[model samples]
Target: MSEADARLQDMELPTALYESTDDGYLATALTIGPWDAGLQHAGPPAALLLREAERAGAIEGGQTVRMAYDIFAPVPVGPVRITASVVRPGRRIELVETVLTAGDERPLMRLSAWRMRARSDGAAPEPPAPHPAASGPEESRRELAAFFTTEVAYHRALDWRFPTGSFNSPGPASAWTTPRCTLVAGEPMTPLQHLLVMTDAASGISAVLDWTTATFANVDLLVSLHRPPRGDWLGMDAVTTLGGTGAAQCTAVLFDAEGPIGRSAQSLFVEPR
Candidate 1:
């Protein structure tokens, strides 16, 4: 990995084990960086909750799972409780919900993850035309450094290249990306996790009246995963729209070699810079 990538990889939660008390509750404390939003930190905490369910034998092999997180409040930089409960346990599918609460038991975020079994057969669709190659990382990184605040901690888990040139000048900028960090211990970093990371990077270029378009924080994020990520190289083609009222939105359709894997949308708060 490059130096920047190595730096990013080292920032993730290094451990999964959570300390439990006699009451069987797992709680831990964390510090959030200035640029770190709640959603970005939500994934690791949610994963920890899932692992807890696994250790308790609530979920097993040969099953499929789906997970979602609802951000209730900004994640605090301190101790919080992560709790998991099984909603439905089926022979082939399992439904699980996890919650992270701050001190005094106020909800910070809630996640509902699904687990299920795989089918033996499936149909095939024609593949899409290939995207043009992206630009080198060194160039893209320099452009990114100009707008994004250097203070926020960014996990360099992925290598990103932009084929279309700098987003700072305007128009379409496409990025090809791959993970530099090793994913969670047993889980192979599914498409869900890929979407979780790449979805937030879509709005990096536009300039809004309230906030700088570069490195905008997402107020809400939603991703629809259509297929498993087939290759290490994934592509993101993003566009931004600014409203007269001073807010903005960015949408990016993400793809892998097999085809269009999924798309992501973000609602952002902006003010004139």
Candidate 2:
């Protein structure tokens, strides 16, 4: 194994998905997704872009309220470049755009985030009701070997537990997940980054169609947060809807150990395998 790969294996949690290089960055195995060996999971690139956007637009006491990602091409596992810029700078609210591209500058994904100042307010809206406590990862661990036969690194890097549906079955499902690696090595992942990593699991957690005979590729991921999440465990109560047409949607309520913090939605293009 390469030195970089060796370093990644030593970490309990993947710190980052890519290692910096002279030109751009190298996509680690940790960035691999379920669909293909060459393609990466959407969460890693999204989180990476968010990290860059946050750096470009430094919000002192602000929190990300909304993040929208458009996946134009399959994010391949190799050298990639990322760029971020402030679209709308403000004292109370800021808008930032971040893009990811291949070595040849082929656009892979684009993310837009809205960050707003956080302050104490007596009239703040009440938080959503928390989902009932479920089994922890230890008690409810579910193996994903059957569904994801490929050697996807990110799949093995996370601990997943299903309370409603198994990976082989298809239906509305609820799951709790915790990452075993950091987004980038050395740089600790923030709560927001942690949440962003799990937000892309909407389609896998709740599938409206069969996995063997159908393919549901999420084209976009939209997440809105009401409050900052706390703790290692993230919950996803997801439901998927399929139309007669070739379009589908998956929506999920996001949660930390405490309660509901936000929601995430994904637009999927369904096709027969």
Most accurate candidate by TM-score: 2
The alpha-carbon deviation from the true structure for residue 175 of candidate 2, after best TM-score superposition, in angstroms, is 1.0
What TM-score does each of the candidates earn? 0.64, 0.89
What C-alpha lDDT does candidate 1 achieve relative to the native structure? 0.53
Determine which window of 10 residues in candidate 2 has minimal summed lDDT.
Answer: 143-152
**Model 2, stretches more than 4 Å misplaced?**
1-16, 124-128, 132-139
Best by lDDT: 2
Q: Candidate 1, residues 1-273: lDDT per residue as tens digits?
A: 447546755665433222444543332222222244332344344444445444433534533233455667666544556677778877677777767776678876676666665565567755574543343334444333233333233333445566664445565567766654433433465544555555555666333322343334556555555455566667677877877565778777777755576666677666533
> Alpha-carbon error at 141 in model 1, in Å?
8.2
